[model samples]
Target: MNQVVASAPGKLYIAGEYAVVEPGHPAILVAVDQFLTVKVSHSETVGTIHSSHYSNIPLQWRRENGKMIVDERENPFHYLLAAIDYTERYVKECKKELSIYHLGVESELDSSSGLKYGLGSSAAVTVATVRALLKYYDLDITDDLVFKLSVLAHLSVKSNGSFGDIAAATYTGWLAYSSFDREWVREKLNTHSITALIELDWPAFMVEQLSPPEELKLLIGWTGSPASTTSLVDQVRAKREAKEENYQFFLQESKSCVEKMIRAFRDKDLSAIQKEIRQNRLLLKNMSESTRVPIETSALQTLCDFAEQYNGAAKSSGAGGGDCGIALFDRKASLLDLVSKWEEHDITLLPLQVYTRS
Candidate 1:
């Protein structure tokens, strides 16, 4: 009997987000402090994995709307089948069969706020699944191929994604990936290289010593309004089609801003970093669609107003309108002062992290 324990973390894009959705858009993503872990061990049965956390979740191979259906709710049997099929394929490829297995998933992050920051929980699951399956079957899977397969599995789960999450989770460090058409390239950087980048991962790219830790803070203001990502992405696409020139201008400017941001990181220029963040957010605010919800209700306007008051910068995280928005402060700003000001609101101020993933 063999078993494997594997985990994949969530990712955050400090710069590129909506632009990544456009064709040929290059972006960088860092695996963040969140993740889902899956453990697979050999068991007696050929089918059926007992999943304790989620409801009747199953993975299967079948036809849905004329397409191969990999999973559907209540498909525990399907997950077992998927594990067997994947394991058998790996074994055959390796010219060996290590036998049957049992698998369970435990993603550390909670949905307590039901807040799906949309960092790739499913992609993390896919990464863990393939790794556990291959390890259990006694085969070596390359990280590149693992990433490719993970992306395929992700598309199988949801077709609209750009694969940013898969890229960040598969590789153990910060990644510079073009998610739109799946163009990926990675640069290894030790935590010292970008004092802001911190984590418990490989540090083989730059300076050997780590930068002194600084207390990072974020002031999050919730508008209590949320919107649909599908509709928002569609809206952006529509606007771009109608106003190609203006949109292209923003794209070029945003790309320049991102490049400068990368340089600011390398130079340790905090002011430059803040400048780029503000510039990029401005371009996105005017060019992109409304935060999916009208700014009035979405708190998009309110957050904007607050950012001005605090002398900081703010930007929406996900498809917009609601969910969460990130408010980046100048490194010298007082975190406690910001917190005291925000204490009366329902908003949550989370400790911020800038890290190269492992």
Candidate 2:
């Protein structure tokens, strides 16, 4: 067995969503500090998987009797590994003998339980894992390969992904991505401008890899627990499919909001960011009656209510309906006070920074 290492970035969704799947809409994202690390250690025939791909998948599986069978009937690892293989063209290009060397893989970073913030953690892992395998085999992989492989891996794994997080994390900065190209285009953004706006009077927040820049007064709140993002997404898709409604408005508004958010980043205008997210909430709500379907369980409503009281702004961060939400505030923000409230609601608070890693 050969030892090979691979890594991928965590993600933050700035804007552009379900709409981006179409041809023109652009999805915006910023890589977060967290990451996924895969260490592909080879063995003569030793192969076992340890993962948190989903809540129920067991820890171990194997290939035997000329078939890739698993101990668990429902483990998605085989599917996950298949996506990687497809993305990296592993089965297509590798010699049959080398292919038997199952990767003793590990997804070092799991999804954040604190909030169902729809960052591209899953896709990032896929990209990194495939990248590691390609590197291990001395194969030349391109950015396009990474991006496409990531999408395939993610959609295959979760069926309810938007690819925004993966694109942002993979590029390690603000990015403008389109599903059409199946690639992430990196854009170097000046975070100082955005941070400065967020700071104005109080201490400024720094954007860097997964580390909190400093103690500040930023508030985080949630309502509903994490739910199947796919469910809500499917709802939206179904509505569009029936022609009962049009997402054009949602698409246009989301694109517009993201465009504004990027400016806010450049301008460091907390107010603008806040306002944009608020608009995003309304649009998402309109897309589907998510607010009625136990939005309270997500604590999304509670957080927004809290933010409103403090003259701050809040909205779901990832795919809405569950998981996590993002809150933005100026001098009016207070994280400490919110912690007790969030704790009372049993919601975890994770303070995250924009990715500044090179």
Candidate 3:
């Protein structure tokens, strides 16, 4: 039996959360060491998806009339199914076919106790599944193809997303990314099929490689609570649509702060990076207030305050009602002291680092 295995890393947003959804606004993201893995093996009769994280019972699926059908009751692998469907569509567009297979999907992106760490698990799983299926069929898969398929599959499931996580999973390192035009995507979705969307000239979505300074120390602390990113993003989007002026101001300020941080990264200016981190945190706080969305929870605020006392910078990494907050410090700063402070606040330190693709 032919088998193929592939994995993709989860992501953390360093800067530009709500604002990055706007077309052309840039956000910095880092792919973390944690990854979701997918294994594909040839199946003689039927397709099945097995995940230890979800259950012992394997979910059966089949492709009929060029569409995927799966048992939807208590199904937890919709993203995987969606990815496979999208990849199959792409392959069909290229005048090809994918063989029947049994897929095993799993992840190490969550806490030991099964709490989600707000690390782009769905995006990583989608990317990994797409890569595994393409490799299993001996199809040539480029990074651009992986990204587009992953985004298409994700959008089919959620309908609204920025896809920074998809970019991070595909690129597999630190990246400075500009948002693709959401309006353009919606229009294309209305008029085109998934295969046709892949062939279209995508709008100005840009991603650039970036590196943190050598003297910088990165730490992630889990707040033991999960935030509903979809709910938070939807609330903010509705508010922005209603009050354009306030959201526009937030976007401009966030863009400015992100630009400063990028410049600091290019110049290797630690002080400037620290300053921008603080400014970005404040901008998010103001945005939370204006949108009436709890982007930063009390626990995250306390985490930032503790980091500030040690002259380090900290903020909620993603949509930020709760989950994980990242802290940045100089090499000379005492990690022991900071960890102790976090422990006192009952926050758990997540031992994660940036992952680079080989």
Candidate 4:
């Protein structure tokens, strides 16, 4: 049997975290070299799904009257199952016959101990599955369509995510992204056909490619603590509901800061980029203080402090609390100084590079 393989890279946020949760707010992100790969092949009878990240034994399922039926309790494959079901629906919408398939996944986004690195694994896996299946079934695949399909499947499983990770996985590179109004998409999903939905213009959704300054060097460090982005976002949202004015202030300020950063990237100005990084870090700090959500854990603070002490600009990479922090410095700077300081605090330097589909 012939199998088609496809992969999607993970991502890290450079700036605009909590604010990006709101519709139309911009954030900077980059795709990392780590990837989740999916392999899809034809199956005449029972469809089997296997994942290196989820289970040692392969999960089995079959279609019933064209609907996928798997144990709902097998939560580890929830995202994968959702991706398959939605992609099949899209195939059926295109007047194609549904067929059984064996799908398997291999992932490098997590450590051997299964510790997540906050590298957007869910989005990467979903994208990889969709891409592999689309190729296996001989369908036309575009980055935008793959992104929309991935977003649709992801939203079906979890509704609150900004889906910026989906965009980052779909378009592998540095990006300035503004989230689409998910509420609008959710309302439309109930009434529109999947084909029509994919074709419609999503309001406030924008993805622009960016080029980093040649002199800029990015550094990533893991604090050896995993953070739940979903939970952190929920906590921040719960707290911010009571302080609407302050939340709005944060959103506006983040928008301005990210826009300037985007311009700096476009202009290839390393100094301006570092300045905006510093400003964005302060904005996140203020937001965390007001919301009482520890966006920056003590370990992450140490990581950033060491970077700053070594003449670099730094901040937490994602929803913070734990996971990883990122720093940027001029290529001419001595990284050994910051490395030694980070070592004193048990911070592990991650050897990750920007991933682009050349």
Give the Cα RMSD of candidate 2: 10.0
Full-model lDDT, candidate 4: 0.91
lDDT of 2: 0.56
* lDDT values, one for every candidate: 0.55, 0.56, 0.86, 0.91
Cα lDDT for residue 135, model 1? Answer: 70
TM-score of 2: 0.72
Off by over 4 Å in 2: 52-75, 87-102, 105-121, 140-142, 154-160, 181-224, 241-246, 290-298, 331-334
| Ranking of candidates on lDDT, top first | 4, 3, 2, 1
Name the weakest run of 10 consecutive residues (lDDT summed) in model 4.
67-76
Q: What is the TM-score of candidate 3?
A: 0.95
Q: Estimate, for each residue in 234-279, the C-alpha lDDT of model 1 and write its tens digit.
A: 6676656667787777677766787676676556566666677677
lDDT of 2 by residue, 1-358 (tens): 4678877766655455566665456555566566667766654554555555454333444556545555556565644565554543443334433334445444434444444345455676677777777776667766655555565566455455556665665657656665543232111112223222222321111122222213223444434355665676666666575543356666787778766766665666666667776777777666656223333234677766766676766666556566666666665355567667777876667665566545
lDDT of 2 at 157: 51
Best first by TM-score, ranked: 4, 3, 1, 2
Which window of ten consecutive residues has the lowest lDDT sum in model 3?
91-100
**lDDT accuracy of residue 176 in candidate 3:** 90
Taking every candidate in turn, the Cα RMSD to the unseen true structure, in Å, is 8.6, 10.0, 1.7, 1.0
Total backbone clashes of model 2?
25
Highest lDDT scorer: 4
Winner of 2 and 3 under lDDT: 3
